[model samples]
Target: SFLSIAIGQETPYKAVVVTDGHQALETVTHVLVDLLLLDYTLPTMNGIELYDQLHAMPGLEATPAIIFTASLVKHQDVIEQRKIIGLGKPIELDELLSTIERLIA
Candidate 1:
């Protein structure tokens, strides 16, 4: 993916791809994630719902996240409520890398 390529070029960051929310949940429980890049549409649970679950996990409340979606509808309220960054789908590589850099820094 673009993220893997971009992040690879700029830093030594490793990307972990999860197929669904359940896998994401399991991964989070076992890993120490610095930042989260979540798709708004996921099987079983949506990004916001997954974020809620992650936030409720011990020691993850302040983890920075970026939620991306292809849909036109914007969940401004939920984004604000969760204090997470949101990105539109077909994410620009530069924008994604910049956001990731900012969040990780």
Candidate 2:
């Protein structure tokens, strides 16, 4: 649904989400090399971990990602890491909207 809509859109936009960590990584590495990713923290592999993996990749060194999590305790550390953004969960529409605006901008 979302992936299809994202790919089909006339604008320069595309997205994909896979709940499994291994699959997500593989998909990104293979199926979707050109995409900028926004992954949720509570996922099977955890968003921070995924971000780190992607960040280390040769072509992905400058790629952007947003991490959505339910825990504020981990927020400061992620922000301190300096390449990722943390969005707290319950996933409010306005908050998500704001984060997306900031991310895409």
Candidate 3:
């Protein structure tokens, strides 16, 4: 739901949406290797765990990720430990944009 709006706003470029963390992991082999990886995922493997894996890979450590989750309260330990920008659910447009701009800037 939220990703669609973000991709639309950033369009004229390509967009690939992976529905699950497992699929995302698999796609990383074929799709992510060719692009700049920007992640926003929840639970399952969680963002930081996925990011940690990506960082250890040869060419992905420097890639940036924005951790979007509905479980902020539950995952405070993981979020804080990783220094991730937690974009909470309910999607506040301004805050999301500000975080993205700050990250990309």
Candidate 4:
């Protein structure tokens, strides 16, 4: 995955890639996650819904996240209301790295 490779190469953090929300939930359930980089248009569940489920998990409630969406205008209100950092599709790697460094620190 492009995102995974970029993250792995650009930062010291570990990066894991899951194809869909189901895989995400499964992987995250076992592994400790410092930051969440989510696509708002995931299969089976939207990013917000997945975020809710992930947030409900113990020890992960306060975990930082960046939600990327193509339909930013459509989800603007929700993203703004939440603590999650919102990013648009075809993200700028520089911006993403900057946010990740700030949040993960």
TM-score against truth, every candidate: 0.90, 0.68, 0.66, 0.95
Model 3, 1-105: lDDT tens per residue?
565567458643344677666666777777654333334564477567777776677666666566666777876687677666666776676776666556555
The C-alpha stretches of model 2 lying farther than 4 A from their native spots are 1-12, 31-44
- For 1-105, candidate 4 gives per-residue lDDT tens digits of 888899889999889988788898899979999999999998889899898899998888899989999888889889888788999888999999999999997
Candidate 3 residue 43 Cα shift, in angstroms, is 8.1
lDDT of 2: 0.60
How much does candidate 3 score in TM-score?
0.66
Please state every model's RMSD to the true fold in angstroms: 1.5, 3.7, 3.6, 0.9
Clashing pairs in 1: none
Ranking by TM-score: 4, 1, 2, 3
How far off is model 1, as Cα RMSD?
A: 1.5
Question: Which ten residues in a row are the worst by lDDT in model 2?
Answer: 2-11
Candidate lDDT (C-alpha), each: 0.86, 0.60, 0.62, 0.90
Candidate 4 TM-score versus the reference: 0.95
- Model 2, span 25-73: residue lDDT tens: 6876676454444555544666667777777777777766666567756
